[model samples]
Target chain A: MQPGEQRDEVEMLSLMLLIRRFEERASQQYQAQKIGGFCHLYIGQEAVVTGALAAVRDDDYVITAYRDHAYALARGTSADACMAELFGKETGCSRGLGGSMHFFDRKNHMYGGHAIVGAHVPLAVGMAFAIKYRGEDRVTLCFFGDGAINQGSFHEALNLAALYKLPIVFICENNLFAMGTSVKRSTSLKQIVDRAEGYDIPGEIVDGMNFREVRDKVAEIVDSIRKEAHPAFLEVRTYRYRGHSMSDPASYRTKQELEKYRLDDPITRLRAQLTREGKLTNEQFDMLDKRAKETVLAAVKFAEKSPEMPVEQVYDYVYFNGAKE
Target chain B: MREITYRQALNEALAEELERDPNVFLMGEEVAEYHGAYKVSQGLLERFGPRRIIDTPISENGFAGLGIGAAMVGLRPIIEFMTFSLSLVAFDQVVNNAPNMFLMSGGQFNVPITFRGPNGPAHQLAATHSHATENFYASVPGLKVCAPATPSDAKGLLKTAVRDDNPVLVLEAELLYSSKGMVEPPDEELLIPLGKADVKREGTDVSIICYAQTVPLALKVAAQLEEENISAEIVDLRSIKPLDEQTVFDSVAKTHRVVIVEQDHPFCGVGAEICYRIQKNIFDALDAQILRVSQEDVPMPYNERLEKAVLPNADKLVTAVKQVCYA
Candidate 1:
């Protein structure tokens, strides 16, 4: 491996570990009743977000559906704020107004973690439209699950993005199952990328399990979109280790299937690849794991120490000029 | 001031806002190449270029969400639904996404978008086409719903809607598009504020409150009542959501009776809210129980005479006013 490639792989492994640890802690918090509402962990889908986000510009906007804790962290949102948001605290990214489902950081150009499935797809296209209208070269990376492809919004968004040639990268994290229903049971076409062909936009499927593969494919696609000022679709094939949400028992899939994917864990595979290249030793891997755990624990402390949003301020932030207040 | 059609006034508003702010652009099906479905955006494409005056596909959900996204990123997008009935396809984007984004994002993002189009009962455009959606949109907290009646108000309020920091829904009347009224010159820049009501015709015996397509009916009823020496007042509710409740209550206090005229059906409609607010705030001031003249509860029919029968008109408002006056 080239020196830069080796360094990139190491950084990717570190972020994947951080995301995995963060989500594991989130799952625990949800079970402990510290986190309320629907908690959809991104434990198994870390490589997709981490790899895709690594290829985009810092100013480029990012929007995704409910399962977005990992995406938020990958897009530069601090773990503390994300944790505080999950805790519904005043110091949260959404000021406690949005919990788990909606996470927004304007400074980092992370538009939001929209709760509604496939709803924010058009918004991503619009952001791309604005970028092109303003003559800016920035592209928007919109993430959705395999399930969102079935929504009319996904088709409409793709049509407009292709029609106007908006600079957008639509990344579908096809984790095999959407919520509880497997893609095979719900979608007529098993391949999500095939839907993009109808819109006449370039689309391809990448192995979402491999961090290097996802990162390289996304970088190439995003680079082309930036140059051509058009939208592209990517279907990242990956798996989720956890259930759809904290409340789900995941009875649909068998233990063997879960174990199969566990072996193909993105973090484990990346760590092994780095180790084989001598870029990371066993001590280094242990240190990275220890560091991620420390970061997650610190985030938990921050969230616990964070005060609850005052009851009186519940109606705040409803409008820009304080119309409601 | 010069007499111009309501369509021209709306077109002027779009052209003026586009000229004032480089970030402002118009997007909708037929808004550009076709010069708008109702010619409300006529000549805008030629002036602003294709980039600024975008012509989208028949994808309401797609474009509406796209406009919201653009608004979040700092561009002011004017999303024209051919009619609000068509906006239903993109209702999730309008109702859930646009309005809730600012609050949900902790005020990190403000969607400064305007969704404007010909709305309410018009001619024989039956069932699916004729939808008076003021009540539906106005019920939402974050959205600012405007139903302008006159050409001047159409021009002024639309300009304000484009400039407002929040998502504003400009519900125009299809029937009132060609209705002529005096509007200020483009350089004068007339801008009517939202959430304020205009007493079109002031009187004492009774008040005829209405908006959008029903405003003309109320005005005609007021004129007809003047002949009978009843002295009726006409309150045009330009802004529906942040309703001018004070004006409504003041009119009720003076007249002691009110008859709400709305194009929408009576149940939980704009008239229903007006009636409830009047009773809640100025109950003692009312000398007679308030009455409401609204469209019959049925799907709009394709037959012209039947369509007219289903809608509330000047004669209906006049009769409603007389019943309230006990004449």
Candidate 2:
């Protein structure tokens, strides 16, 4: 194995670990009532974002659905800001205006953490449109879950993206169940990639349980997208260990099914790969895990210490032209 | 100043703004090759080319959200709905995503998009096509609604909507598109700022509060009231949101009576808001119970006669004004 590949693999492994630790802490905080409002943990689906974000350029645009904390962290948003955002503190990424669902960092090119299912897909198309209009080489990485594909907006977005040949990669992370209903009940198609046949766009299915696999496939797809300014659909098959949100107990899934998926967790798969490749030692793995825990603990402290947004500034940002609400 | 149709004034406003800013673009269903369904964007394709003048499919929600996304990244997008009635399908994008983007992202993003098209009941167009959506958009906190009554205001207000940093909706009337009115040339840079009411006709007896298509209706009623010696003032609320409350209150204080005219339903319409604002602020000045001349609270009928009866017209305005004037 090349030295650089080993280094990248380690970086991705550490990132997935950080995200995992951050979410576990978030779940604890939400239970404690410190972090309120529909917190969706990105526990088992770390590699999907960790890898896709790794493949894209820094200036390339990225947008996703509400399950967005992992994407934000992977895109270089500080864990403190992400945690504070969940806590709805002024120090949060959205200045506390957007709770756990809406994380926006303009300088990082992270467009937003849009909550509405399938609504932001067209926004991604428009971002790609703007890039094409400006004659730029930027490609947009749009992420959503299995639930969003049923929306008409998603199909419309895909049609427009294909029509204009916009540089965008529609990444669908099909983590088994969309809230309660599984794909067997909701989606009619046998495979999610088949949906792309209507638009005549190229589609691929990737195993999202391994960081290396996701990173390599996305890098290939993004390279073609950047050069040709065409669109591609990628369905990443992964699983979520936790419930849909803090409130959901996930009663639909049996204990055996949950346990079965947990064994194939993305974090474990990446760690095993690194260890097998002789790139990670036992002490180093333990050290990395401790460091991730420490980082998350520090973030929680930061979020706890951060002040709440003042009431006087409630009307702020209602309009960019300074008109009162 | 030359007399031009409201459609031509809007066309000129779009042309001028597109010429001024390279980032500005127009996108809608028939805006490009079709030259706009109502021909409001006629000849724009030849001038601006297909790059800036884009034509989308019949996907209002998709394209509306696309415009908001483009606006989020510094592009000024003028999204045209063939009619405001069709914009109901793109309600989430219009009322939620576009307006709330600025605030939701903690001010990290600004959606400088304008959703413009012919709005309100016109001719014999049935219920689905005829929607006075001023109240719907004006009620949104981040959206600024413009109802230009004349060609000059159409051009000026549209140019301002394009130039403004916020999301502005220029609500034009399909009937008024063909009507001719004086409009200053583009070289004059006519920009009527939002939240300023234009007193269409000044009188001391009664203030006829109105906007958009109702502005013309109120003016005609004022002319009819002139023959009866019941002088009526016309206050055209050009901007619905961030409404010209100062001008409305001043007009109410001076006239001591108000007859509001709106193309929308009576309940919770712009006229209803105006009534509440007037009575809440200038209650003592009111000589009578503030009257409203609004469209009947029912779906528009397809028949021409029934449509006219359902809409706010000179007759409704005259009657409301007479009651306010005690004549």
Candidate 3:
């Protein structure tokens, strides 16, 4: 491997490890009742977000659906703040107002972790429209599940984005399941990327389990979007090891199916690739794993120590800059 | 001052705001090439060019969410809904996304968007087309609901709605769009601040409070009441959400009898809130029981006579006023 490729592999590996450790810790917290509301973990699907975000620029915007812990962390939000948000503490990224489903960091240009199924797609399109309207070269990266592709909002947003020739990259994390129902049952078109052709936009399907492939393809796509000022769609085929949410027992899927996806574990595969290439020693891999655990534990401690939002302030923030009165 | 139609006043407001602020743009179905569904945005496309005056697909959810997204990044978007009844299709975008973004994001984002369109019953457009959406939008915490009753108020209030930082819903009456009234020049800084009620015509015997299309009904009823020697007061509630409670209470304190006339149904409507507030604050000041004249609680019929019967009119307001005044 080239020196530059080695560096990219290491960075991608670290992000995947961090997201895996953080999600595992969050799962434990959810079981312990420390975290409430819908907690959707991004355990097996870490490569999709970590790799796609690798192509994002500092000024560009990122928005996604409820499975957002990894997205927020990858966008440079501190793990402590993200964990605190899960704990509903005042120091959280959303100041405890938005729990697991909604995490917003404007400084990082991470628009939000929107909860409504397919709602934020148009919002991302709007942001891209603003960028193009103002003659800026920035692009917005919008992520949603395969289920969202069937929504009218998804189609409408894609049509608008393509018609206006706005700069945007729509990444569909096709996890094969929309909550408990498989994509085949929910969507008539099995392949999510195929639907993009209806809107006259370029579409591609990527191996979401491979971080290197995701990183390279997304980087190329984002660069093209910036140059051409047009929209594109990517269908990243991935899976989730855990259930849809904290309360879900995942009764519909078989344990054998879960075990099969475990074989294609993104982090494990990346670690092996680095080790075989002689770019990372076992000792270094162990240290990285150890550090990831430590970081997650520290984030837990910070969230536990953080104060709850005051009950009286619940009414605040309904409007910004005050309502016209 | 000059006389202008309510449609012209709205067109002038959009034109003036588009010229004043480079960040301001208009987007909706038929707003550009079609000159707006109601021609309220007439001639804007020729003046502002295509970039500023954009026509969107008939996807309310998409365009409404896009408008909110634009507002987040320092652009003020005026989203027209064709008619507010069509806004229901994009209700999630307006109620869930636009309003909650500011609070849910902890004030990092403020959605400065104005959703304007003709609202309430007009002619015999039937059930799906006509809707009194002011009460529905006013019930939301983050949205500001405004319904202008006249050409002047339409011009002034729309300017404020476009300039305000919060998400404002300007529900213009379809029936009043062609009605002419005196308005200040387009270039004149004629912004009527929101949350201030206008006493269209003042008297002492009874107070007939209304907004939007009902304001005209109240005015007509007041004239008839004057002929009957019943001094009736007409109050046009320009702003519905940040309702001018002080102005309403002051008028009620003097008149001692209140009758709320609204195009919306009576159950939990804007008038219901007004009735509650007045009775709660100054219940002892009332000499007669508070009453309300509202559209019948049924889907609007297609027939003209049935539609007219379902809607509130001057004759209904006159009867409501007489009942309150004991005349």
B135-160 in candidate 2: lDDT tens per residue? 88888989999899999999989999
Ranking by lDDT: 3, 2, 1
lDDT of 3 by residue, A1-325 (tens): 1211233777768878889999999999989999998999999998898778776676888999999989889888999999999999988999888889999898888889899999999999999999999999888999999889988888899999999999999999999899999988888885788999999999999999998888888888988987879999999999999989988889989999999999999998888889999989989988888888899999999999999878887677887676421
Where model 2 places Cα greater than 4 Å from the true spot, the runs are A1-7, A322-325
Tens digits of per-residue lDDT for model 2 on A213-254?
888898899888777899999999998888999889999989
The TM-score between candidate 2 and the true structure equals 0.98
- The collision pairs in model 3 are none
Order of quality (TM-score): 2, 3, 1
| Interface C-alpha root-mean-square deviation of candidate 2 | 3.0
**Model 1 complex DockQ against the native:** 0.67
- Listed for each candidate, the true contacts retained, as a fraction, are 0.86, 0.73, 0.75
Model 3: CA > 4 A from native: A1-7, A322-325
* Per-model tally of clashing residue pairs: 0, 0, 0
- Pairs of colliding residues, candidate 2: none
Q: Find the candidate with the highest lDDT and give its number.
A: 3
Better of 1 and 2 by DockQ: 1
What's the true lDDT of residue B251 in model 2? Answer: 90
Provide the TM-score for each candidate, comma-separated: 0.97, 0.98, 0.98
